[model samples]
Structure formats: structure tokens, C-alpha cells
Target: MSRWSSSLWIPIVAVAILIGSILTGGRADSDPQGRPVVVYAHPPCPPDLMRYFEEAFADFRQSHPEINLQVLHITGNYEDKIKVMFAGKVAPDVIFMYPTALPAWVELGALRPLNDLLGTNVADYFAAGVRT
Candidate 1:
């Protein structure tokens, strides 16, 4: 699979965890009424995969009726757009990006460390992905 294809699960898993946390009142940063979680994904996805993403979102919505979720699919120049969003302090809660960009985002404090959010379950992620 292409790197992007493999990386797709990262956002899905993150979303699942976020929804779970919200449902159980495990995420302190989230409001009791549940805050909207904005997700940003890049293009180049196959039609079938896009369908899967939609299905996942639908399931999430059904399971967590109180949570507001928004997905933005970025087309050309995704990195630049993400940078602009960060500059405007409108970065999405979930971001799909190339691993190479992680360091810069981390340095800029645009990304949160997921160790606490993910806990030991993070070991399930690929070593390279964990590193990223």
C-alpha cells in the first residue's frame, strides 16, 4: 500500500478514541456537551476508500450523537493550506499529513503529543508511524 493509504487508519483510530473519550467524559479538554472535532484530509484517495471514510464518519456520528464533527478534504497544496490554517489558529483537531511534516508541526506546537490520549495502545501503531 502507498504510505498515504496506510496512514489513513491513523485518523480513523484517532477519531474513534476521541469519540470514546467524549462519551465517557475522559477527555478534559472536551466540553460536556462535546466540542466539534474538525478533521482535515488530503485528496488522492481512491473512490472506495473515500466511501469507507464516509462510512466511518457516519458510524461515529451515530455512536456519538452529541459530538459535532466536520471533515475538510484538501486538494492541491495541502501543506500550504495547513500552514495557513495554523497561522490563523484554525488548525483542525485531526490532521492527515505526510510524516515528513511532523517535526515542523511539533516544533511549531501545532500538533499535540498523543501518548496520553493513546496510552499503551499506541504500541499497536507501526514503529515508523509512532516515530512520526
Candidate 2:
């Protein structure tokens, strides 16, 4: 693979496994049928980028048979839609936001500090800035 594609792998892998790890706690199963549903909501991306995410999630689904993975690519007016979701007290298990929106969400207390649960793992997968 080219250097560019290879570089994308680390973050993609992190995001894929993060869907299950962060939300599932240690149970790995929510329903009596024994499969926890994991929903990840991301803003719309270019076709290529979305393809990469879908491929990564496909791999994640195959690897984690115990979890049901649902990817929601929210299209158009992402920020507004997300705000409406929070207003309605509806949110996905995993949410992806750009750097600019991060502060607002933090202020609204929509996100929780994962320091206890993730420890150094976040640092290991994400950039230094994302940790803060």
C-alpha cells in the first residue's frame, strides 16, 4: 500500500474498535439475544473517505461478531442536526465531531470524560490535541 493509505489505517482501526470498546463497557452484550447494538454517527464525508470508513466498519463487524454495528452518516447541516438531536435528548453511542464543534459540545456536557475508562488508550490512538 502507498504511504498515504497506510497512514489512514491506524485511525480507522482505532475508530472501528472504539465503537465497541467505549460503549459496551465489559459486558459486550446488551440484549438477551447476546448482541449489543453499537451506533456510530459521523458527519458526511467525501465518497472516498466514507468508503474507507465503511470498509473499516465492515472489518470491525466481522471481527466483533458479538456486536451489531450501525453507521449513521448524517448528511447536510450536520451541526444543526446534531444540536436538534441533543435537544430531543437523543444521541448516538459514538459521535464524531470536528475540532471547532468540540468546545460547544463539551460546554453542553454532551460528552463525558473518558479518562477513567480509556486511560492512555486515547492518547495511543488519537492525537495529543484530541485528548484535551
Candidate 3:
């Protein structure tokens, strides 16, 4: 795997958890079932990693079955795809993107600030990780 892909694996799972929380309001009994949470990521993984990724999602589903997850792996130009998604009003609830693209997304009003969601636990993230 490339350096970017390796580095993103853990964070992608983290984002999935966050999405689950957001969709279910952190409550399994919140009637979150059937609510769809779309996720857009790049460069489909190799077979082994793909199995692992699917397993992770399966585990999440076991706990939060109400929230439906739709994951899309893009192999072409990610930025262009993202732009098209936003323009078409079909952007994913979670996007696995390189940090470098954040500013442009923010400037275009395509991204929402996550500060409120992160709250005082911001220190839990690495300084470099939060910088993006």
C-alpha cells in the first residue's frame, strides 16, 4: 500500500464511528435504522485489506444496524469526483480525503466545521492531524 493509504486506514474507521454517532445520536434506540450515511473514499484496497475494511463495517453494523452505510471507492480523480458530488448535491456524509484538499473544500462551503462535534477532546488528536 502507498504511504497515504496506510496512514488513512485508521482514520477512515474513526470517521465511520463518528458517522454512526452522528446518525444515531449516540443512541442505539434512537430509531436510526434505515438512515443512510454515504461515505466516499479513494483507491479501493487489495483483497486482504478490503476484507478487513468490510469486517470493520460489519462490526459497526452489528452495534448500529439502524444506520445504513454506503461506501464508494473512487479510483479516478478524487477531487473532480468530489466537486461533481457537491455540485450535484449528493456529497457523501463522510469523505476520506487528503488533508491538502480541506482548505479548498472549506472555501467552497462544501465542508462543515467539526469543532462542535470534537469539543474539548480536541487534544486527543495529534497536532499535525488536527492541522488539516
- Highest TM-score: which candidate? 2
Candidate 1 lDDT by residue in tens digits, 48-119: 889998898899989977776667788778878888767755567788867778788888888887767667
How high is each candidate's TM-score? 0.57, 0.66, 0.57
- Which parts of model 2 have CA positions greater than 4 angstroms off? 1-32, 119-131
The alpha-carbon lDDT assigned to residue 46 of candidate 3 equals 79
RMSD of each: 16.0, 16.5, 15.4
Those runs of model 3 whose alpha carbons end farther than 4 Å from true positions after fitting are 1-36, 119-124, 127-132
Name the regions of candidate 1 deviating beyond 4 angstroms. 1-35, 119-132
Residue-wise lDDT of candidate 3 within 1-132, one digit each (tens)? Answer: 698898998899999986776665533322355475645454556778788878887888788766766667776777788787677555676787677777888888988767678888888988876775
- TM-score of candidate 1 on Cα atoms, chains taken together: 0.57
Candidate 2 residue 89 Cα shift, in angstroms, is 1.7
How would the candidate models be sorted by lDDT, starting from the highest? 2, 1, 3
User: Model 2, range 30-70, lDDT digits (tens) per residue?
Assistant: 56666887878889889988888888999998999899887
RMSD to the native, candidate 2?
16.5
